[model samples]
Target: MKRFCFTAVSLLVVPVTILVAGPAGNGECIRTPKGDITIHIINHATFALGWSNLTIYVDPVGPQARFAHLAKPDLVLITDIHADHLSVDTIREIITDKTLFVVPPAVAEQLAQPLCQRSTVMTNGQAATVLGIKIEAVPMYNTTRQRLQYHPKGRGNGYVLTLADTRIYISGDTEDIPEMRALKDIDIAFVCMNLPYTMTVEQAASAVREFKPRIVYPYHCRGSDLEKFKALVGTDLGIDVRLRDWYNK
Candidate 1:
């Protein structure tokens, strides 16, 4: 009986150690009042959202990206035709017959052949439901006069995904637009802040503060000061500013 007891304890110890040492896959699963969400940051402006097995890839790019390890996406959303946002090669590599492609009109126009068949076009303010998730296309554009032509309003989109009562905003590539500030009841937000195309760190923080998402992940901030973002959200509004390794090796 004592031998059997020792053997049982040894088996439990091995499993526990493996669990403790295992790679904490992708991003942590966040439990909000609405539902559970797992965010996988792939690089600047690229991420995968997993709610159950229905994975959603947003702005997938990066030549070295490996989707083999990731859950097969039921739907993929491309905000624009920018190289960082929509790479035809990358999309072709990851797309399966079951995958549904969602994109703005500008991106839709660029699609060819079979890809066009699976594509859904959405302009600003339009809404569509795919794979049990409701997607609202919000305006994403440059307000700066010099950069106005980069992303004209109504040409690109920032998506608002409503999944199981949770409202998640993905600011594709935009400045601190009025629509962003006007948003309410946002559970999670993935806001972008980079120079030449989108808002600065200050602008991103200000917009986030106005909307007051329960949690905000500062993504697509390639050449911006992310520390400033954390400092801006420090201890006031109770907004959780999560920092993931979306950049660097």
Candidate 2:
């Protein structure tokens, strides 16, 4: 994968090799009239996004080795208090003084004072602007009775980021809740699925089918059958199911 090379002042796009080439590299980028957003799929639920001059890390967890090659984050977004999504050790290793942590209230309550002091807490239906990008906190929870304890309502957050005209939805550990199915005009969506923890592949596909994001990438899915997900929501429905290697070798 090529390095994310762009200048905020110049807005110059380097050669096609710059950021994941034409959907054939580590990730993809969308160039809109206002700016560009490049997505880097790290591991698990962790992802690094390059938008203009800012580097945004979402649900970043795991070892420091997983993120050695990337730029230091300008902003970090934590969706839940789960260890997989929010790691204080990992945060200590990657964050700088300027890196602001964006999290929901549930996550805020669980974080230590050092983290909370620098964190911006947003609740469901709340919006905030960080690094000139609009971020809205959406609720993520389990609608299924048995799985309710795994993720109760208002405990975690799914997020919608508006970059130029593009809207990217990041589904933090959740089932097929009404909030997810009710989203509108999502250009890119990162959805989670697995047994016992989140939704099944069928549930993930069903939510994606209803929302109809232009492109959908299934992440945080270890044991779930992605092939079945693709078949269930075929291209005929006009939704592109993008399969990425979210788990390590």
Best-fitting candidate, scored by lDDT: 2
Question: What TM value does model 2 have?
Answer: 0.88
Task: For candidate 1, report its TM-score.
Answer: 0.87
Write one digit per residue (lDDT tens) for candidate 2, span 1-249.
212211111111111111122451445676555666788889889998887888899988988988887889998999998889988889889989888878887777766776677677777787776677777888899888889899988878898887656678999999988999998878888999997989999999998999988888899898999999999888877787889888863
Q: Pick the candidate with the highest TM-score.
A: 2
Give residue 124's lDDT in candidate 2 (0 to 100): 76
Provide the RMSD of all predictions against the true structure, rounded to 1 decimal.
14.3, 8.1
- Write candidate 1's Cα lDDT for 38-157 as tens digits: 777788889988875688999888664556668778899999888989888888788788888778878877777567667667778777777777778889999999889899888888
Residue-pair clashes, model 1? 0
Every model's TM-score: 0.87, 0.88
Off by over 4 Å in 1: 1-24, 32-35
